[model samples]
Target: MWTKYSTLRATLKLHENADISQYGRLIAFLKNGSKNHKPKKAKVLEREHIQQFLVEAPNTKFSMMKVALLFGV
Candidate 1:
């Protein structure tokens, strides 16, 4: 919707020489209407999972990533 609105706005400005400032209120409304997105929570590894991962990680193809995973966890 925002993309379509932007395209329509650009078309009007280019073809009709319309002043976009007239739609300030509508723009504000559209901006506020799209702010309902919620952020996702980060997943945490369990202590047992971490222990098992450390135990088996050394021999895996991704062994080099163990240090990075340890720091990230």
Candidate 2:
């Protein structure tokens, strides 16, 4: 098992004043999970399970930053 961190900076995108969603969200796309951001979980058996877990992780900490998540495999 490994650990990772979410990118509060990249998701914030301070460089651009992009328009947020009607509910206030970013439209930027990412090819992979953020290198710094990842979700917490117990041991897993498959990679697919990792993907699913990360997707459902609630942003309990940075609930306001709209941070992007990433993981280490």
Candidate 3:
């Protein structure tokens, strides 16, 4: 069974040959948040999920700046 993450990596590799650097950044962001925030799963994340992350992130005991940087907000 293909896990969501494996599917995502395969999809990116198969169809997204351009903008490799941007994809690299996205992959890295999914794997590890900027310096403080916990990592989030990009494979199944939706818009609502992102919003939730943004909302709950600040409350965590991490640098606010780090969360902002992670989201580019």
Candidate 4:
């Protein structure tokens, strides 16, 4: 049986090599869209998909601005 602590420990170990800010950004993105909706599963993002996202994303939003800065596009 998987306990909450065990799950968290496993997840931390799994992502220990990953950038911590990326994790924070992902969690924030999930929380932002999770209101009155089910969260979607994670998948690898493709360049085309990201480009589409950037194009459709509102320019006035801070998150999109950060994304633009991060991707330099």
Candidate 5:
């Protein structure tokens, strides 16, 4: 959504010569407003789950995916 907003702003600036300064208050609100803000709870993986993943990931065809997941985690 923020990306779309930035694209629109850029397009308007480049093609329409829009007066985007008039939208400063709106941009500020979108950036700092609490209305749509929600904290996501982190999901905890059990020891058994991690062990099973380690055992099974190597048997799959997605070897690169397994490597990426290992590094990412």
Candidate 6:
């Protein structure tokens, strides 16, 4: 059974996809959402990717690479 637990889930939804059904569900799910939240997925970074991102990254602190991956470079 692959049923979703509507009770224990956090109410954090975004209008990422333009689908009507998805957008409506997202609205219901995040109707009572909080400000502080974290995404479930973790970004994976390779040395090669970082090297490429560094070239186009702006500023020393917030670079394109840093924003690209949710994690660190």
Cα deviation at 32, candidate 3, in Å, is 34
lDDT scores of the candidates, listed in order? 0.80, 0.44, 0.62, 0.64, 0.76, 0.52
Query: For residues 9-34, could you state the per-residue lDDT of candidate 2 as single tens digits?
Result: 44545556532332222223232334
Instruction: Please write out the lDDT profile of model 5 over residues 36-56, one tens digit for every residue.
Output: 778799999898887688777
Q: Write the per-residue lDDT of candidate 6 for residues 1-73, one digit (tens) a residue.
A: 0023342232222333233344566656665453445558988878888777666666686665466664654
- The residue pairs in collision within model 3 are none
| TM-score of candidate 2 versus the correct structure, residues matched by position | 0.23
User: How far off is residue 73 in model 6, in Å?
Assistant: 10
| lDDT (10s digit) by residue, model 4, range 1-73 | 1244356656776888533334766567656765667558999879887777677777777575757657887
After superposition, the stretches of candidate 1 with alpha carbons farther than 4 Å from their true spots are 38-73
lDDT of 3 by residue, 5-65 (tens): 5676667778984334355666676557445655576787677876677666766565675
Instruction: Indicate which candidate wins on TM-score.
Output: 1
**Segments in model 5 whose C-alpha atoms lie over 4 Å from true places:** 1-3, 28-36, 41-52, 69-73
Give the distance in Å from residue 52's predicted Cα in candidate 4 to where it truly belongs.
0.8
Q: What ranking of all candidate models by lDDT puts the best one first? A: 1, 5, 4, 3, 6, 2
Could you tell me which residue pairs clash in candidate 2?
Answer: 5-36, 5-37, 6-37, 21-25, 34-70, 37-70
The residue ranges of model 4 lying beyond 4 angstroms of the native Cα positions read: 5-41, 62-65, 68-73
In model 3, how large is the Cα lDDT of residue 71?
79
Say which candidate scores most in lDDT.
Answer: 1
The per-residue C-alpha lDDT of model 4 at residue 39 equals: 52
Q: What does candidate 5 score on TM?
A: 0.42
Where is model 3 more than 4 Å wrong at Cα? 1-42, 58-60, 69-73
Q: TM-score of model 3 relative to the true fold?
A: 0.25
